[model samples]
Target: MKILKFISVLAILVILVFSFWIYRSLNAPYSHNKNNQYIQIPQGSSPGQILVKLTSEGIISSPIPLKIYLKITGTGKEMQAGEYLFNSPITPLEVLSELKSGKLRTVKLTIPEGFTRFDIAKRITGQFPQNQAAGEDAVLKLTEDISLIKDIAPQAKNLEGYMYPNTYNFPRAVTTQAIIKQMVEEFKKVWKPEYADRASELKLKPHQIITIASLVETESRLDEERPVIASVIYNRLKKGMPLGIDQTAVYIAKMENRWDGVINKSDLESNSPYNTRKIIGLPPGPISSVSESSIKAALYPATTNYIYYVLNVDKEDKSHRFYSTAAEFERGKAAYQTWLKKERK
Candidate 1:
């Protein structure tokens, strides 16, 4: 009986010691590396190998405790391989959680609404890896391959309005093609079947709807104002009048690789089919990326006689004042020009 009692007490003591060790290993904050240090775990790496790598990099004091903890918990099989950024003072448990999440450390690239293909290409070229022909021009050329979006935008000459603008976190080694592909895929996700039905109901092609949406996106930032701007575009098109959107001229300058942050008179007078001032209908294609709100606005514009919109300098939100007559538009334009001059001063 004494021997059995001694064995029970020893077993209890061992359990208490193991529990304490695990609690310290998993919960205790540890920092042996520089703050925000990154480590790459290669594909197909075993849990043991990964734990050892972390120990060698001083990300953890030792991997033995974690190994024993993993053995007890049965939770290491889901760890993913990727570049991981470990912030200092992170617990081993926290690190394990991050690994299981499978979200590799990524560099975020944000493409704002109304950003043209040129804008995206330039941003991608500057931030991501490029091939031997590494240049902004080369990156722009990749967007020309419309095979990825050909199903929906069959007549698309290039992926101008198709690269959906959003902040995307990509792996460090992500190629320009992969990045562009992901953006187009995101656009597909946003361009739902209902949008297609609405476009058909309005007697507009998918391409035309996207083009009008792009115009609306550039014209107004306010969701409420986008439908109004879309109405203006449709109203002008129905009247067989030029769209006269200045952003198309800006897009032209960008296409010519001479956008010097100023829209020259030459740009306004350019005979490019994309020049909305010169063209009678919608530009040849979308001039910029279209937000879903802009797309919705194009599909369902406010029923109005509005054929013109000018920046409302009086409003704090920078919304537009819509007008049905040239005379009303001229008055709004005069106020906007005055505000512009004063701001320049």
Candidate 2:
């Protein structure tokens, strides 16, 4: 009876010691030397391999305790693979939770509204250089794929005005093609079915609406003035008059690979269909990416007799002054030219 009692006490002490060890292994904080350094666990890596890599990189002190805990919890199979940045003084349990969630490091890329496809391509190439040395020109070619939006805008020559402009976060290994697809998908998401119905009510196609929206986006920065500017475009189109928007001339210059930041006389004289100064209608396609506000403005232009507008130089917000008569337009032009001269000086 005495020997049996001693064995029983020993068994109880052993259980208490093992339980204490397991609790400390999971809950205790371990400060390591590797903090803020990214460690990539390749795809298909086993849990044992992950633990070994982490332990070897000084991200953790030992793998034995974690291994035992993982076995007890039946969670070894749930570990995922991705780029991880572990902080110092982290518990083993916390690390396992992070691994199970598969959180990855990401980089941000921002495309502002009204950016042209060329501008977008340059930004993409600069943010994510090609591993195969396929330069910026190659990235531009990726934008040329029209199949992505064929169902929405079959007449679109390229994704000029369709790539929605916004900030995006992506993994470091993301491809440029994937980035472009995501932007287009975002644009599709913003374009609602009611917008298409509105286009039909205005006797316009989706392509034409997008083109007009692009023009409105580039013309005015103020949301209040966008609908007004859109009205001017509509008025000009109705009267069979040249739009005379200098931005179209700029877009032509860019298409010809000759944009020098200066609108030369030759640019205005160029007979390209996109040169609104020479053309009497909307451009063949969109010149820049369109914003939702600009699209709404195109669909719902305010009712007005105004057919002309010039920069409202008196206002610092780059607003415009509308005019119904050529005489009034000429006066506004004179005032704008005066302001331009003063700004140049």
RMSD of each: 3.4, 1.5
Q: By how many angstroms RMSD does model 1 differ from the true structure?
A: 3.4
Model 2, span 1-345: residue lDDT tens: 999999999999999999899888877888987677888888999889999998998877789888988888889989999888887889988898889988777879999888999888878878775524877778888899999999889988899999998999988889888999999999999999999999999999999999999999999988888999999999999999999889888888888878989999999999998989877899999999988999999999999999999888988888889999999999999999998999999
**Candidate 2, which segments miss by more than 4 Å at Cα?**
none
lDDT of each: 0.89, 0.90
- lDDT tens digits by residue: candidate 1, 175-246: 888999999999999999998999899998999999999999988899988888888888898999998999
Weakest ten-residue segment in model 1 by summed lDDT: 125-134
Off by over 4 Å in 1: 1-31, 63-76, 85-98, 129-133
Question: Cα deviation in Å at residue 263, candidate 2?
Answer: 1.9
- Count clashing pairs, candidate 2: 0
In terms of lDDT, the poorest run of 10 residues in model 2 is: 128-137
Check candidate 2 and list the clashing pairs. none
